[model samples]
Target: DLDDPARVLRSNPETYFKSPEEMYRLFPGREEAVERTLEIAEKCALILQDTGVHLPGFPIPELYRNADEYLERLVMEGLRERIPGAGEDVFTRAHYELDVIKRMKFSGYFLVVWDIVHAAKERGIPVGPGRGSAAGSLVCYALGITSINPMENGLLFERLLNPERVSMPDIDVDFCDERRQEVIEYVIDKYGKDNVCQIITFGRMAARAVVRDVGRVLKIPYGDVDKLAKMIPGPGVTLSKALSTVPELKERYEQDPNVRKLIDLSLSLEGLARHASTHAAGIVITPTRLLDHVPLYRTNKGEVTTQYEMKILEEIGILKIDILGLKTLSHVDKTLRLVAEHEGIDIAMEEIPLDDPKTFELLQKGQTIAVFQLESAGMRDLLKKIAPTTFGDVTAVNALYRPGPLGSDMVSDFIERKHGRKRISYEHPKLEPILRETYGVILYQEQVMQIANDLAGFTLGQADILRRAMGKKKAAVMEKQRERFIEGAVGNGIPKKKARTIFDLMAFFSGYGFNKSHSAAYAMVSMQTAYLKAHHPQAFMAAALTSDMSDTNRLVVLIDECRSLGIVLHAPDINSGGVEFGLSNGEITYGLAAIKNVGVQAVRSIVERREEGGPFKSLFDLCDRIDLRLVNRRVIENLIQSGALDSLPGNRAQKMATLERILTEAQKRQGARDRGQTFLDLLGSAGVSGEIPLEDVPEWDESLRLHKEKESLGFY
Candidate 1:
C-alpha cells in the first residue's frame, strides 16, 4: 500500500511543497518507487484529440438514395411552398447551400433537425422561427427547419458553416415550453434511449463566491466576509487582481492575520468546481451506447446525463444539440388557441403579416409588455427613438440595442442617418450595397463577411475566416488577412490606402457586429407577438396572464398591462372559470388555478363536475358534486376569498361561515362513493338543481373583501 506511511516513503508531511531532492533524501531506498511513480504518471496522462464528429445517419424513406437526395427533394418541395413562383436567385442560393451541406457531410444533421421540427409542427407545437447562425442557411429555410428566409434577409450560409474552417454546425431549436419534452422523447425513441442523454454542467466558484465559501468554512463573521467579498469589485475578479486594484482589501490582508489566511486559502480554491448539474438545453446523441464514448452520470433525481459538459462533447466530436423551451412560444400557442376558440379565426404564426399597420403602430408606441425580446425598458426606449417601419428596421433595432453598440455612437449615428439628420456614406462606392440596410452602420457580422467577399475578391468561406479574425482581434491572423485583403483590393481597381482604411473600419465595427440571422429570427417572433397584441388585446393579454400565472410579480405587471390595453379582467367565476385564465364573453376571467391554496387537482375537479352536470347553484351543490378529497377546506376557503363563489347565492363571509359543514358533508359523500355505497342518495339529492341554505352572515365590507381577495389571488 503506497498510502501506508510505514510501508512507503514520503517527504516531510508538514511541508506542502517538496523538491525531488527532498523526496530522495527522505528515502534513499525508495528512489525506484519515485521513478516508477513518474513513469506511471507519464503513462496515465491523457490528451484529447479532435476525432471528427460522429453523427448517426438519419433514416430517410426507401425511395430516396441517401440523406442528401432526400434533403434536396424535401428542400425543393418546401421552397415551392415557402415562395410561390420562386426566382432564379432563390434557386441558386438553395443549390449553393445544398452543395455546401452535402460536401460537409452535414445532410444527416440537417435532416435530423428537420425531422424534429416536422414532428413538433405536425403535433401542433409552436417552434421558434430560428436561433443563432443556423438561420442563415437557405437550406434550413427551405427545409422548414427555420421560418426566416435567408435569401430575403441577406443572411450568409457561410456564416453558419465556414467551409474553410471545418467545425460542427450548431442548430438550436426552440419549442413551446409545455410540449418540449415531446420532441425530446421523440428523439430518444428514434435513437435508442440509452444512446441519448443531456449534457452535464459544472458551476465554478468565482472570486467573491470562493472567498465567502472559504470564510464560511473557516468560521469568520458573515458581515466581515460579506464586506471583504464585496470589496473584490465585480464578478470574476481574482483575489490577486482585487488586492492590486482595491486598496482597502490589500491593506486589511496585510494588517490582519485572519484576512491574510482567508485570502490565501481563497486564492488556492478559487475557480474550482463548486457543483455539477445538468445543462439547461444541451443534449448529446451518440451513435452507439453513450457509455462506450463518455461516462454516464445519474443526477439526484435519477435523470441520466453525460459526465462531460457541452464544450467537452463538442471538442470530442459528439452530436450535441440545444432543445430550448421558450415560454414565449407557449404564450403564442395559447393566444392563437384562444383566438380560434372564441373568435373562430385560426392564426398561424407563419401567416402573420410582417407589415401589419396595427403591429407597427403598437411597436412605435413602445407598448410591448409581454412581447418577446423587446419588453425591456431600454429596448422600449430604443423602439420609440427608432420608430421602426420595415421588418428590416426591426431586425436592425434588435441588433443595435446590445451593449457594444449602445455604448458607442453607432446607435445614435445610425438613428441620425435613418432620420435624414446625418449623411450616410460608405467607405467606398462598392460597399454601398452591403451597408445600405443599416444606413452604412455595418451592424451585422454577415455584413463584415460581405465586404470582404465583394471588395477584397475573397470567397465566402475565406471571408468568413476574415470575419472571425477581425472579431477575435488575433494580431498575427489579422496582419496576414490585412495584407491579403489589401493586395486583392488593389488588383480589383481599389487604391491600397483606401483598401487599408476600409479594412480598419471593418475591424473597429466587427466588435459590435451582431449575428443578423439571430436578430432576424428574433424579430420574427417579436412581430408575431406584436401582431397578436395589436389585433386581439383581450385574448393575447389573457394568454399572457395565463403563461405567467405562477409568478406573482409577473402577474402584477401583466394585469397592469391588461388595464393599459383597456382589457377588463373579471374575478374568477365558480361556474365558468377554467384552470387557466380564460376569455369569456369579451373579458378576461381569472383562473381558479391562479388562486393560492387551490391546486390544479382542485380546479380540475371543479371544472369537470360543472361540465358533467351543470352550474353550481349553491356551495353545497358544488362541494357535494365535486370530489371533495381534492378540493379540501383550505381550497374551498381560497375559492371563497378569491370571489370564485361570488356568482353563487352566498357572499364571501357567508360562504366561509358554512365552508366546514359543506366540506364535512361532501367528504362523507365522497368516502361513501369510494367504498361503493350509493345509500347516501336515498337521504337527499345534493345535485346542482337543489339549493342548500347558507348560515346567515353579513357580507364582508369592501375593504375586507378586497384585502382577502388580494391575499387569495396575487392581485385584486
Candidate 2:
C-alpha cells in the first residue's frame, strides 16, 4: 500500500471521493497488506552508536616535535609581528589562550586554521579580518587567523571557547569570492584529496512549497493552487497551523472537498527532504581517507561529498570548517588593486586610518551605495538618522539594523540616545560601564557576558552559557540560570529585586544581541569600502561595477550612482576596454565582456591582438589582425552596435553597412595567410588594400543609438 499510489489514494476518502462500494472494490486487499507489513516491521529494529570527536591531524614541520609545540612557536612569532611593542597584557593574554587551547586539545585545530589562512594571505587572496566568535580570540589575532584585536575590542576569549563547556571551536574563515576556490584547492592539496570532502545538505519542502508542488502534481488549476499557497503565512508555517489560525483557509478546507484533499496531501508531504545539495561553506577534513568512516556520495556535478550531514558528521568526530566566500572581500581586493595601479599609491588595508573624516562624512550623508553591509535602504536611513561620526557608530549601526532590534523600539532608542534626543540611562549603576559604548542599549552579546561578570560575579565561561540559554529560551535551563544569576547578584551586595530585574533585562536582550566580534569585523570591511569611495571615487565605482557586471539592474543603479558622483562612464571601446570595467584617465570604461554575446575568450583575443599589434586603425585592420574564429562576425556586430567600435573610422550605421565587405576581405586574407601565402600575396588580395565603398546613411538618432546600446549592453 505504501508503494501503490492508487491504493494510498483509495485509503483517504477525501482524496478518492468514491462511494463505499467503489472504495471497497478498489482497495480490496489494502487492509490485509497493511496488517502484514506492520507485523514484519515489528521484527526489524536497529540502534545507532555515538562515536566521539574525530578531529583531523595537522601536519607539522619536522623542526617542531608535535602540533602543540608548532602552534605555540607560530603564535609567539606572529605576536612579535602583530604587536611589535608587546606589553605584559599582550603576552599574558596570548599565554593564557594558549593554555586553554592546549587544555581543550584544540591546538591542532587552531594550527590548521592558521595554516590555511596564512597560505591565503601569502598568495595575496583577500581574507576578511575575521568572522563570527572566532574574532574574540587573541590567539587567532596573533596567529594571523583573524585580524580583529580582541583585547582592544573588549572581546572575551571564553565567549569563543568556554573552558567549562567542551565543544569543537568553530572558526569560519571568509575569503574573496573570486579567489575562494583557489584557497579550497590549496587545502585539498595540503590535506590529501581523499581525506577532504564537502558536506551534503538536504532541502525540505516547507509548508507553502509543498502545497504548490502537490497541487501541480494533482493537476489542480494554477489560480487555486496559488490561492491556497498564499493562505500559508510566515516562514516554516505548517498546514495544520494555517488551517487553525487562518479563517478563510479553514472555511475553504471545510467546505471544498478538493481543498481538503490538497491540504491533507500537503501536510503529509511537508517537512520531508526533497533534494540534496552541497553546503556552500561546510567542508570536512578527516584525519584518514573519508570513506573509511562515513559513507560518501557524488553530486550531479561529480564532486565528492559525505552522505552524512554536518550535525551527524560532527557527532561522529569530524572537523567541519565553514570557508565562506564573501563578495565584499572581492570588492576590497579589486579596489586596492585599482588604487595602487591608478593613484601610484600602494595602500595597505590594515594601515588605513579607521577614523578618516571623509569616510564618516560619506556615512553621515548616507551615500553608501556599495558599502559592505550598509547598502540596504533601512541601514542607509538609519545612517542618516544617527549621522555616525566614529568607527564605533558604524559597528553599532551594523548590529542594531537587524530585524529584532529594528522591530522593537531599540533602534529608535539607540538613534535618539546617540543624537542626544533622549537621555542614556541604565537600570543599575554597574551597567553604565558595560553599556557606555552602545549608548546604554544592549546591542551586543558581549555586553551580556560583561553584565553577568561585573554584576553577578559569574565567570565569562558561565556567562556565555547563560547567554546561550537565553538565546535558546529553553524553559528548564533558563529557569535554572535565572535562579543562579539572582543568587550570584545578591551575593555581590545588590538587592534581590534589582538583581532579578537586571537578569530579566539581560535575558530579554540576549535573545537578539549581535555578536560584537562579527560586527566589528564586518564593520571594518564596510569602513574600508566607504573610505575608498570617499578617497578614490572612480576606482571604487569601477571596481564595484565590475563586481556586479552580470546583474543588469544592479548595473543601472550603479551607473546612476556613478553619474551622481560626477564620474563619467565611457562606452565600451575595443581599443581600450579590458575584460572587466576598468578606470582609465579618471573615467570608467565599460568592459567588453559586459556586452551580450561577447564571451571572455573573445575579449581576451581582441585585447591580446591589440597588445601584440598596436590598436586597430580601422574595421579592416581589426579583422585582419585578430583571429576570426574567436572574434567572429556575430561578435563584431555586437561590438559595433554596443559602440565598442566607435573609435574606428566610421559611424555605427556606416560600420554596420560595411561589416559584410570587411569580413569577406578579412576572411580571404586570413585563408591566404593560413595557406602560407606571402605577405605580398595577402596585400595584393582583391579589395584588401582599396577602400570599400559603404552605403552612406544618416547617423542613428540619439534614441535609436541608445536603444541599440541597451539591446546589446542590457542597459543604456
Candidate 3:
C-alpha cells in the first residue's frame, strides 16, 4: 500500500490484508520482484574514482617553458606598472604564492583567470577587485587578476590555498553584468566551445511550498492551505518539526483525517527535486570535450549545459569557474564612460584614491541608495550608526552587516567601539596588532587565522583548517582541533586557561567571520559607487538608471534618487535622447527605448536620422527622413505621448490629431524614395512638399498630458 497507489485504491475493502493469510495470498511474487530489483541495482551500480584536476591549457608562447614562467613574467611586468617601487615584501609574498600554485599544478589556473580579466580590462569592461579568498593571494594582485593588495590588507595566502590540504583553489571573477556574456564568449573562443559548458543546478520543494502544492493537488481551499503553510514557522523547518511545534497543526493532524492525509502527502513530497535550472555563476571548462566527461543537455534557450552540478564537477576533477555577473560592475563601467563623455576626463578605476574623504562622508550619512552591497535598509541603518571614516571602516562594516553578525551583538559592539562608546580590549595584548583595525572585534576570517598564528604556535595553513572546523561545528573534529590549539598555545608559554578562553572566543566568532578578501573587494566597489554618487551625481544616476532600465520599480527609485540629488531629468527628446539614458547639458535625459510600446529599432532610426540630417526640424522632417517601417505609427504615438517629440512644432494633442495624415504623407514619400526618385522629383511629389499642414487642435491639458506620459513612460 505504501509503494503502490493503484493497489491501495483497488484492493477489496474487507479482504485488504486483513490477516496474515490474506496478505500471503495478495502478492505472491512481491518478495521475488524485490530481490530481482536489488540484483539489477547491484549490477548497475558504478563506482566513480577520483581523477586529478583537469584544466584548459593557457595559450603561452613557445619561448616560455611552462605556464609558471609565463605567469611569473606577467606578474613582474604587471607589478612594475601597478606599483613601481614595490619592495622586497611584495616580491617575497608573490614568490611564495607562486611556489604553492606551481606545486599544486595550478599555474595554468592563475593564467586562465589572469587572461580573462586582462581581456575584460582591455575591452573596457569593469572587473571587480576580487572575490573570496583569491584576494588573499599577492600573486593575484601582481598578475592583475585581483586589484586588492594582500600585503597592505594583511590577507593570508594560506587561507586561500593551503599546502597542507589538497583542494582546488577557487578564484571566481566578477565582470560587468551587461557584458559578462561577452567575456564568456571570449573564453569559449580561447578554449574550444565544445570543451566549455555551464553547470546545471536543481531546486527542491521546501516544506511550505510542498504543503501548498500538495494541498492544491488535493483540491483544498487556498486560504486553508496558506494558513497551514505559514504555520510551518521558519526556513528549513520540516513538516514533522512543524507538527510537533505548533499546537494547531498537531490538533488538525490528529482530529481531521483529510488534514492527516494532506500532511502525509506533503511530507512525502517535501525536499524532493522540483526542477532543474542553470547555475547562476558556475561554468566549467574541461581540458577536452566536455561531453566525454559529463553528459550535456540543452537549456530552454538552447544553451548547452552539463548534467552535473558544481559539487559533482569539482569532485570529478573538472575546473569550475564562477563568472559572476555583478550589476555594480555595470554601474561603474557606465558611470566612468559617462564621466569621460560628458566631463571629458577619463577616470581610471585603480587610480581613484581609496581614502577619499568625500566618499566616506557620503557613507557616513547613509546616502547609499544604489551603492553596491551596502544599500539595504538594515545595512543603511548600520552605516548611520558606524559613521565610517576610513576605508577599513567601510570594509569592516561590510563584513559585520551580514545575517549572523547582525543577529548577534557583534554589530552593536563594533559600532559602539568605533564611536568610542565602548572600550576596545583584546583577549591578550599580543592580539592588538591583528584586531586593531576592526576595533578588537573579530569581524573577519583572516583575523582568526592571524590570532592562531600569533598567540598559538600554529602555521597559517593549520590555522585555516581550524577555522574550517570551527565553521562546520563538527563535534568530534572541533574537540580535536580545540585540544591541538590549547597544546600549541601552552607550548608557546601561554597558560592553558587563557588559551582555552581564546579558543572558545575564536570558535564562537568564526561562525560569523566574514571573508576579509571578499569584504575588501566589495567594499572597493561600494566606495567607487559612493564616490561617483557624491562627486558626479548626474552621471552616476544616469548610469544607474540605464543599468536598471528593464525594472520599472528600480527605475522609479533611481529617478527619485536623481531628484533628491538636485539633478533635473529631461524627457526624451528625438534630437537629444540616445537609446539609453544619457547626460544632456548637465541633466539626465530619459531613454527613448525606455518608453512603453517604443522599440530599439525605432529609437535607433530616430537618432540616426537626427544625426545624419541635423536636428529634426519638424514632424514632417522626422517622418520624411526616418525609415517609416522602423518608426511606425504606434512607435510615433508612444514617442509623442512620452514627450520625445516635444521639440517639434506641435503639442502632443495636435500631433495625435494629425498623426495619421503625417504617416500617410511619410509613407508616400518613403515609397517614392525607395523607387529611386530624384530630389527634384521628391520635392515635386504631393506628400514631399515643403510642409504638411496639421489639423487645428489645442494642446493637451497638464493632467491629460501627465496621464498620457504615465501610460507611455510607466510613470508620471
Candidate 2: where is the Cα deviation over 4 Å? 1-51, 683-685, 688-691
Judging by TM-score against the true structure, name the best candidate.
Answer: 2
Q: Report the lDDT tens digits of candidate 2 across residue range 401-498.
A: 88899889998898899989999998889999889999999989999999999988998999999899899999999999999989999998889999
lDDT rank order = 1, 2, 3
**Model 3 C-alpha lDDT per residue in residues 599-684, reported as the tens digit of each score:** 77788888888888899888877888899888888998888998889998978898899888777877877898899997777664
> Model 2, residue 278: displacement in angstroms?
1.3
Report the lDDT tens digits of candidate 1 across residue range 1-716. 52233675666856676778888898899999976877897899766665677887688899999989999999999999999999999999889888888888888888888988998899888899999998999888888889998888898898888888778889999999999999899999989898899999999989999998988888889999999999998866788999999999999999999999899988998888999999988898888899878989999989999988788787788888899999999999999999999999988899999999999999999999999899999999999999989999999989998889999999999899999999999879999999998998989999988888999899999998998899889999999999999999998999999999999999999999999999999999999999999999988999998999888889899999888878889878888889999998989988889888888888998899999999988888888898876777889888899888989986889889988877776777767778788664525454543345788999999999999988988777
Off by over 4 Å in 1: 1-51, 235-261, 676-692
Candidate 2 backbone clash number: 2
Query: Which residue pairs in candidate 2 collide?
Result: 53-317, 54-317
TM-score of each: 0.90, 0.92, 0.91
Which ranges in model 3 have alpha carbons more than 4 Å from their true place? 1-4, 7-47, 234-247, 678-690
| Residue 31 of model 1, lDDT score | 92
lDDT of 1 at 519: 96
Screening candidate 3 with a backbone cut-off below 3 angstroms (N, C-alpha, C), the clashing residue pairs are none
